[model samples]
Target: MTTTRTVNRAARIVLPGVVAGVLAASALAGSPAHAADEEVPGLHLVTLTGPGTSATPPVTGAPDAQAVLLARQDAVLETIGGPATAYRWTTALNGFAVELTADQVTALESNDDVAAIEANTVRPMAGHVDLSAVRFSRSSDPRASRGAGGSGVVIGFVDSGIAPDSPLFSEVRGLGETRAGFSGTCSPGEGWPASTCNRKVVGAGWWVEGFGPDRIRSSESLSALDVVGHGTQVASVAAGNSDVSVLMNGRTMTSFSGVAPQAKVAPYKACWAAPDPADDGCSTADLVSAIDQATADGVDVLNVAVAGPTTTDTVERALLGAAEADIVVVGAAGNGRSAFAAHASPWVTTVGAARGNTLRGRVSVVGGPAFTGASRSRRQLGPVALVLGADVAADGAPTEDARRCLPGSLDARQVAGRAVACLRGGIGRVDKSEAVALADGVAMVLVNDRPGALVDDFHTVPTVQLSVADGTRLTRWMKRHDRTTVRLAGVGIEKDASEAARWSAPGDDRASLLKPDVVALGEGVLGAVPDAWALFSGTSAASARASGVAALLRAKHGHWSASVVRSVLTTTARPLAGTSTLVQGAGRVRASLPRPGLALDIAPTRYRDALEDVSWEDLNVSSIIMRGGGTTTRRVTNLGTRAEYFSVSARGFVRHRVRTTPVALRLGPGESASVRITVTGGGNPSRFDDGWIVWRGARGSHTRIPVAISR
Candidate 1:
């Protein structure tokens, strides 16, 4: 759990980019720009292509393939007689989702058994974790304190549901059974019953017919529980139930766990919570029906956490049919430091969001000045009386809404028993510490008028936050001290106050590959939510700890495939340091892996021919971009055993030249090798270059990969 590494210099991507056939465009078909076919109303979807398609249930010879895709969606609704259907989708896609009408979406775009239709939109919700800050890998078996590694994998969690009485989700002792091609179950709805799925939450569903039961809001939950706490804090950061503890306002504070704390959690739910509880969404036909019910419930790592599609939609062809059925999805690279990152479908594994070292709180001030910040408030106040939330407004409020403590705009006799300070934006930061604990304030400092990531959250009182130069030096020492004082203190851990995260989201030169295929830790992490345990921060909690490190590498390589577990977590990441490669791409996310003795895998029919070809810069990916200075080729294989060799070395092209035809390699065990590389100079075409190639294995074992280049 140490990790420092440092390098920083990877941000350029503003070119004449994104034209190479835009993922072979053409998925969301017509209807909206009308003025004549006039019938346009709502809810759509469609999707069906070739071979009796439906998606999940027994689909090979199409065993009644969702009743032959519902008799080809009731023969396109009895030849445009329209009106009935509202959902069908076989497994993760084969599709239907009804209620259209711009002349039945221009007659299902001249139906050839429709391959795309459109009109479903809604998406939102994306937002946890720390398992030894990603050094991850534990499990020396003494039952390793009850399986510390992800035993039989599982991990589905589409989003927004699951609290099944959180004790971080107990019952995981030895975690043995449950794996025979899992078929997923647990349905019980409304407060989530079905005995709340035991064995660490085995399964649980939810959908909402593409989020529309009149926009939910009858206090949420039509079942799979999680009354808006981001799917029980992203299924407790992917597979909860381990050391647990972590409380907060009721004390406790630390013992966490998850990142495969013995994996197995299914969830599903597909996001909801709207009537403005700060809005929430999800519906691309309920995320392609919860990715075709977690790919017909055989789940083995999915965790989308919303906002995907950079092209070929229908939720990126249901995450390319959940990575051609071997699963391992993991998405969310969206939060916005000027947007760009958001699951650009390279068969997912996107991630992004970093800023390690956390747990803060401190604050100080007595004769003025101390700092620290973020915090899960472990209480302790002292020399209190600090004031300034615009000096406690309330009566006639709006002094900038009592300096941003908006809720009721302060002034409980100048914030009772003192502390206040406020000012951060207008709303949430735990609602300005619940408007300074509803004006009976006893703490809260907040501050930040820009300059990002401080967030430890879970507050109700004793908080801290700050930054923006320590909130302008405590608002200029409380406008040049008259009384002031302060304190708060207590909490702990600190270090990385910042390194990437102005809302982590930058990877867009329109894809030739090199998206947020990595980066983790994600701001203040912590996890579990319903029955308490908080502190979140986004990239959907680094896509649920990269789907708990792809369920602890599919519970120890049970024949690794979803593109060799995304090329062994993008060539064994660990690159960060002042970020680039369009903001932390192949970096930070080390679950102690390092043994990709060479891999690259790809095939989902070459990602459906790079989504129907213009050649996605030759896709055998392990992160290499080259955009302007090109020449590609890859291959690899030989995942370890006898006759090894390697040698290669490239290390950060800086201005590019990189040639690589054979710098040395031997292979033999399961043999395979190719290489080629190229990348000429790097002069302009919109700058931005990156590095790392490495290989080096004569038994000191190494792999690395990464590489980038702009023009």
Candidate 2:
């Protein structure tokens, strides 16, 4: 189980004007001078008092700043007994990550120069995009032409390495010049070479420890390339050039395009291939090094497709530095099906997964309901004898195995001329279908084991998957009749509005702050693999799509601040139905050129020890209500040059009980205004209710602030 620190309501801090308030409150409350030593062992991040302001650390090469930080580092080493290898310096945070014993941490905390010490938390990889969904296509938004599909912008991927030779990264397709700000280089080692760096793929490097050169190879291929295929897929989703095509199932021709086709890419291979090709592992050391280099190289957008536990050490500090430098950083929300830690940092835009278009084979019972399922089989079968696997298990096979259609568990004689009905769970979906094929079954009917949404999967035989409820009925009917039959149709692609992927992680960090800032198309997203095309899923793909959108925004509005770019994407997102802010966040990211109407920018909450403390929440109105009512304020700044008229109205289930003061406002160009939102109890207090506070402008530009009310 993962442990988290709970912060009390008194510690809640609002943004814009709460900095001084929090400081005053802390001082008046007379908080303890020193925190009790948690005594947790492992690498710990030790922050020291720097000579500059908290918001901006001294420049990387400043002589005076370096001297002060070096002195502080020596003092920490003296107390912790480090031979320099015991810790690593993160110049951006003026801190060092050192492996220390509990006693050493206690001793270091006592040092006058040491500001804070936190255990280096482990972050797991969180494991993309449709350009049309985000208005990146030329047909959807004319502004796409203005940026030349995000030319001149550099997007850096800090995950698995990319396939350097993929046609998607060809410079002839208009991959523009490398930005002058980037100074990173391609360090050739093992199977990787300097030629991997090109005009389109501007930089390539890897950082791994403990594992020697031989262990660096991906599980699938022997080289520094993306043997896991994830890096290649994600990188292509973000910035691959146009006219890409995939020969699906070896026959279907499917054309593919990235969100920002003209953006430059920098591959920073920070993760190492795990024994299992499906899972890639990354260390805090390699990740931080990659981030430091990516930032120094001046990448405009950083797309991290990995997730892990929230850490106050190396990862957070590097991300903070990137944010301070105005880089739009995107990360995954994990695949754990719950709120995750690594993507909890406020400085990063945490993305969740949503459904995209998929190809599936339609299945229908002779006298039952039809269902949609995925299968790679091209054959169409009709009115075949369908027998449940449980009814024909081999005498010596385990009953559970028979039900799951495990290999060698079924009686071949009984299943040879019939279609097998297999229960889901206990094994891979594809494996089950393969087992049926091994048993000589004519077709397979896979039943979902649980409720909620279902993702399509490839199968070895003609197969159709049904929902749990539907599958239960079918099984009962088959048992009673003993002569059930079904039909399987040819495969076809199915497209629908994006829905939150069931596997995407949920959020409300330890501090009750909303995470997964947005959701995007990630399920079954087709993108480049080393020399071919394959469909990839996970929050990693969604984050890449978001990073690509950020690149497009940056290329078009080169003058906009990173915060503004984030604001535009979040505020303008299309909210998914039947999902909450915790699941979908600000909603699916959308992109468009700046318009003349109301464009609002709300600042994020600032904390005194933000980099060292991992307990801060983003500055939105998502709050828990203890009393019958609670009030929060937000400052909205207009970026348009003309006076904009807007009306504020609360919409959604909880809206009826919530009211905003000053329901109307007219602001001049570059003007700022404030509004107070009060939520009152009118429904069940035990249940959570959510709604949006929408500021609709007269000119059709809409901005929203999500509000959550809970007891």
In order, the Cα lDDT scores of the candidates are 0.69, 0.64
Clashes of 1: 13
lDDT of 1 by residue, 1-711 (tens): 110111011211111111111000000110001111111238777776632232233636646666766776777677788577777776556667787767777876776666667677666665522211112112221222243777877888888778776666666576656667888899997777788887778888988877777877878878878777777777777777677655434555456677778777888888888787434567677778877878887888888776543555667677777787878788877665545666666778788777676668888888878887878667677888888888779898878888888888888887888888877774556667766777888888887777665656657677888788988977888798788787887678776634565556677754667788887876666676664555566677777877787788878887877788878887777787656767788787786656667777877666655555434566787887666676787888777778888888787667778887888889887688888888887667677778877677777766677776754
Q: Candidate 1, after superposition: displacement of residue 370 in Å?
A: 4.5
**Candidate 2, lDDT over the whole model:** 0.64
TM-score of each: 0.34, 0.74
* Candidate 1 Cα deviation (angstroms), residue 438: 18
Write down the RMSD of candidate 1 (Cα, Å).
Answer: 23.4
Candidate 2 residue-wise lDDT, 139-231, digit = tens: 111112222477889998987778877767766535566656777677786567877677778887776641223444444333346655678
Best by TM-score: 2
